[model samples]
Target: MAKGQVFVSMALALLVFMHVGGIRGEMRGGGEEGDRILALPGQPKVSFQQFSGYVTVNKVVGRALFYWLTEAVHDPLSKPLVVWLNGGPGCSSVAYGASEEIGPFRINKTASGLYLNKFPWNTEANLLFLETPAGVGFSYTNRSSDLFDTGDRRTAKDSLQFLIQWMDRFPRYKTREVYLTGESYAGHYVPQLAKEIVTYNAISKHPIYLKGFMVGNAVTDNYYDNLGTVTYWWSHAMISDRTYRQLINICDFSRLKESNECESLYSYAMDQEFGNIDQYNIYAPPCNNSDGRTNGCTRHTIRLPHRPHPIFRQMSGYDPCTEKYAEIFYNRPDVQKAMHANTTKIPYKWTACNEVLNRNWNDTDVSILPIYRDLIAAGLRIWVFSGDVDSVVPVTATRYSLAQLKLSTKIPWYPWYVKKQVGGWTEVYEGLTFATVRGAGHEVPLFKPRATLQLFRSFLSGQPLPTKS
Candidate 1:
């Protein structure tokens, strides 16, 4: 054949090869087949596909993040992608976001099997739960110092890298609208990562389809969070009048470092005055199992700046301890092998939260409100919802921080209903929506699944929360 004829043949062959490999259009990565989860041990059979594996964010330092994608129940192709992160500065999204809050499977307390969550967010959209920053959950790093050096800045950058690479692996989702969601410290993670996505989209030939972000009881401004937390404690009668006055007069939250006196007072309130209560959900009973393991309640907290306070884990109901079950289920050899996790066989057992990483956290933004402002001005759909009963990152604190934005209220605060009953109250601002889950704690989905699902639906549709019954 002539040289021109041979060139045309080669070009056609290349196109065929790309199409067969699922790389047509804007798709650019591989490994989808290998990552497909056939069946997790003891998991209930479900129709939708599930994929979980690691995505290397850095080669030199050998850092990789783990992710579990639970596709939509009905028509995944028509659904948007929603990414969920949990904040402990070190908590595993696989544990909290996946097993307890929004993901489809809920681990049985016996750790022997899995059950379906009737209100799983995957029912509405494709859910992506990530264990990020290289030290959380099954995600790991070859370099030992990476654990000691992690903070908000590095976490956000690394997460952005993970997304860029992950989208390549599941290239079909490249064009799907993506929304970032998380709670607590993810308030920092979600917005900071959103800023990074917005920045990356401005310069990249193939940008992520980032739509917006929503956070629950997120840590926004340290000053406002601290002020609101103290106020919540006082208003709820968790502390004495004298203690409240002392906290207000002494704690200087504007500063990066809280004084020793401030720390002592705060610690005293939590330890002495707070009693044996679930700080995550004050109205709930504390898990008092002897091992602190049987009840499935794993203690987790987000220490802000220099204030270290112990808080409760995110589980369901009055005293449900679901995290212990997650730890047992995830650490099982068969389960890990099935999910493609712990491939490196790091020298440790999987835990819900990494204390070392959380303790050694190097830096924090002190406030994430600046990034929120930037994203809001960029016309992204930004929503901040709070589970009112949480004292750790209370609704009061969220209100205080958002008040600083001074966005004109487009819709006055009104009751939002689900199933003809008041689910919560919502108020729309010029570029943001603030809603409250009436009786929920820090983790809204865990505490109030149906209401949160309704909230989630509203967020995805870019519609206001239902004002009518």
Candidate 2:
């Protein structure tokens, strides 16, 4: 009788220990499990959970960066975590990357609803979208001056801090492998942040398990980007021969401020490019905001409640007004509350691209190749992909920039197939991988979602893109 009681007591103790250990692991994210979101206003029902809120990078000044986390549909606990960013120096990642690209939902055409994204990144990995630095989206600083005073180094530092503190909120993710990715201006943001993480991991006891980074249609080097733009335009027959010649002969993109002749040619090129079509994807049609358009001259003029930029339009959808539709959906008061985005209720409304930051961007590295080289030397996976049709940051610019690195080709360029069709071409280099998405524009995933997913899956899995016939 005495021996039986002792055995039963020991079993109960072991069970209690296991239960406590499991709870400790579950204590992750932003809310209860750290920032666990109950649900979005119009979000589809799913077993996977989500959370959104701010990570106070600067506790004293209350400089907090907002973030949205969407768990994987299948195995949230076991999958890797991808921290995604969208570039604009001051763009809203939630607005563009999440809503438009790889995120779980897209704003419905009605601009008053949400629709499921069939190929959301959350299907595979846990997705976290951040509004970095400050004064972009709902992120803000108590010292409002920080809005105008953000730069590359400062932004990177704040981002590193946000990740660390964010992990504190979602402790379970502390040990998971992390992939940092972004597009457009994030060419700068991702590399710089990855450097910070690698540097910190060297000294810190609890380090970020950063595996790699990828940027798409990114602004890597200004000179190469500009030169490549003109080259691409001419090569693709998008610009007149005279304009192309003038740009090449007279313009010096390497110069800090372009010469009057260069500026004139550049302006002419842009004017021709932007007039009838979107500058992002050259082949895409212009957003005709007239009666024949989708909304048909509704009272909402794309910015009645929201202040739309005259020069910088909100036309991301297939019709160019999809971006405007996204703006409406995001700006809804109920959406804000559900996502826990604007806890501080900042004054300025959310815009996809923040014009203030773009104009007043205090610092920009001429070339991020040095950083890329360093990361590659550290044995980090480095991939740079481009949308072949993106005039803004065309594949030509990426090719030009990578050529400067002169990495020996490990795998000669070849077409990577998806669904038994050639999706795009890729080259695996000694320290870098270069890829191009065919028939895609500036935002590759938005233009070619399924191909983008195949590309991304191959990247994360450390596999070459399939060449099978």
Candidate 3:
């Protein structure tokens, strides 16, 4: 062949190689032949082995299972089992639950250490955090074409299957008291999963010991959620009464649609100039750059514009608390090894904001109230707690959603006092209790560790929430 011909042939071969490599990368986990259980990095020095179990649903896609940090903890046979999930429709519980909130430990502020939380929920229970559905966290799919358009029903089913396989892996915990807890989006996840567990227990003769569920600042109803936020903003003076009234007129709380009206209303609120209003008093404004430029708004920025908010000052105190813990955690090599977290990955500072993931969550739909009602009827304890400063899922929104239950408020609405003041309020009917967390926002655990722990303790004990006057 001539030199020109040879050069053409070589170029063609290179193109083929690149194309083949790309295809292979995409196909790695789509089929039965390619399914796998992923190994977590930097295993804790403790005794637990990170195990993977596959739940074969269809021929193409299988569920990636994550088991305990067994090496670090005790024997499963002797402990109660709790399955924890973080809501995002796409979030990993291991990433958020284990790293940020009520896990056994909190990641150091610098992501360089592990500090034992004074109020770790797992201390009282054997906790297992799951990255659910097919695409969350370490969970994977062999099919590259698998739909990421997950809804509540699909997630509930996948989680139910995961539980079945998980129990089989650690059969000792099958009869142990099993509680499901999650924050934010897990509001939808927990109820649906519990409903499935209850339904399966009735039909299969093998009952999973599902005792109760807890959701913090969960997204229960979109309409009520928006309305509550507006009210919160007005109450906190985040927006003037004039702006709040405009928001009410322009935005329809009943329908959750991304319309020009909603956008314009939000834009007006964001752009509205207030004279000498304390930004610290309300949550900070949303960043305008949209390029994932800023770290999360300062705690003040994150707070909803509102007056008389419980946790207004608490946001500013997080950094000091996080720093105090980081110092202790980073000093321990064992903890560092267990997290396998890249200290450099810590953002502008080590706070819990992951802009990429947070942005993606905007598309998620959380409509699982029916599931909650179903679980309540099946005799499961359901508790919803809201951080007063979280405008996204404000306390008012939570109360609005509960009001729709029309359950004839058995106990009527009452104040829930902490420290001799009305820290928040609670209302109970049937087995469901909706309460507010005083001095807390979206991430309740970080803001009010003591109050958050108290809520969890009450949940685990199966006791009715205390009424405050």
Candidate 4:
């Protein structure tokens, strides 16, 4: 299927009522055997288990019931818990979190190789990646008539219910420090979920010790985010002054929606001067493959050779695809099963960038800014990271969205040296911090694995940003 049509189908599927009750029928019971969920057979060597059963959220009738992923390594008594959600309102946490970001494994482009990621985010603390608000990923409902028309309110309520059920399943970790993390559109998911957690704590008196949150190159505001992209292009010297002015003048920031038109506007700005800027072209169609016949291969092939060539260029300056992590993730059957993904169904060539866009999620609300403020005020550490080269949710957009907070700069911005003058820069203020990864686009981990690993380590430990000096 064409990528555009596939996205349209996914959007339509969300509109239809597909009963997902049967998928959770076997989720009864408790303990290791019950919790040690195994991935379906035929996946790579990674193995993970689901700890908590389903939670029914009666607060909202049409939108209820959600599930959470438990770390493969268990410590039921006294381990911190982290919950992760991918954006899209329909994208699977397993698809992005497990496969692309912090999960233990990453799939090879051809879906033939599985490699282990040395810095799987879960290594520091227990992690839980969830598909919330139902109809997303594997979390389903028996009510084929259930409403999948989800928003921040429904998602927050459903996620709260899921956490309540999760705690009940493993009571020992009830007091464990809980953190929420996500990327892309999850700029909406994290704050809303945190607010729900705080509200539930106030009323129930039994709260999931919500610690902090981390989001990467997220989408929070429409006007600033769109406008920032134009400035970012100019700052990076990818666009000319005339083209930037054209974008600022012609683009409708108010009716801002993701579509082919958005792609065209950005394309015009980038093509004004072609100096090999992949960031601008990240969302635009390739100049060579306008027919879409060669299938978005033009976009993916720009970084390295396709097909007979190595899928990943080794950062160690050796053969591409030589990293131990990539090899293990692609090859691990357990990780695949835990992800609950069907690699066979997806195209053999899968890059984080090549995934189908969610056309159905054109309208998103940004009212959750207050919730983020509340979390920061409550003394939770917040970290927002961005891949400077990612045009989808670029670093420029992040800065503009954060400017809405009106936060007092407690700590001034400074370079976060990764290796000599490499890595990137970081800024700390009050309880929140923002950082960017050098040479990395949207998928920071995929592009700069070692640097990303270091960033996570510093984030989890609450340690001061590392310096290469």
lDDT of each: 0.81, 0.75, 0.57, 0.59
Listed in order, each prediction's TM-score against the native is 0.89, 0.86, 0.72, 0.75
What lDDT tens digits, residue by residue, belong to model 3 across residues 327-430?
A: 34433434322332221222112222222223223333445667766777778877888888676567777778777776756677777665466656777777
On lDDT, the leading prediction is 1
Model 2 stretches astray by more than 4 angstroms? 1-34, 272-275, 291-319, 343-348
Q: Which digits, one per residue and each the tens of the lDDT, describe model 1 over residues 347-439? A: 346778766677667888878888878998899999999988888889999999999999999999999999898899999999999999988
Candidate 4: misplaced stretches above 4 Å? Answer: 1-24, 27-32, 38-78, 108-114, 142-148, 257-267, 270-357, 419-421
Model 1 RMSD, rounded to 1 decimal: 11.4
The candidate scoring highest on TM-score is 1
Candidate 4 local lDDT, 64-118, one digit each (tens)? 3334454644443445677887775556565567766677655654545556666
- Candidate 3: minimum summed lDDT over ten consecutive residues — where? 303-312
Runs of candidate 1 with Cα error greater than 4 angstroms are 1-30, 289-319, 343-347
lDDT string, candidate 2, 279-338, tens digits? 566676544455644222111211011111212233354444557776777767677667
Consecutive 10-residue window with the lowest summed lDDT within model 1: 18-27
Worst lDDT window (10 residues) for model 2? Answer: 297-306
- Residue ranges of candidate 3 with Cα displaced over 4 Å: 1-59, 65-79, 273-317, 320-366, 412-423, 466-469
Which whole-number lDDT from 0 to 100 does residue 262 have in model 4? 54
Residue 293, candidate 2: C-alpha displacement in angstroms: 13
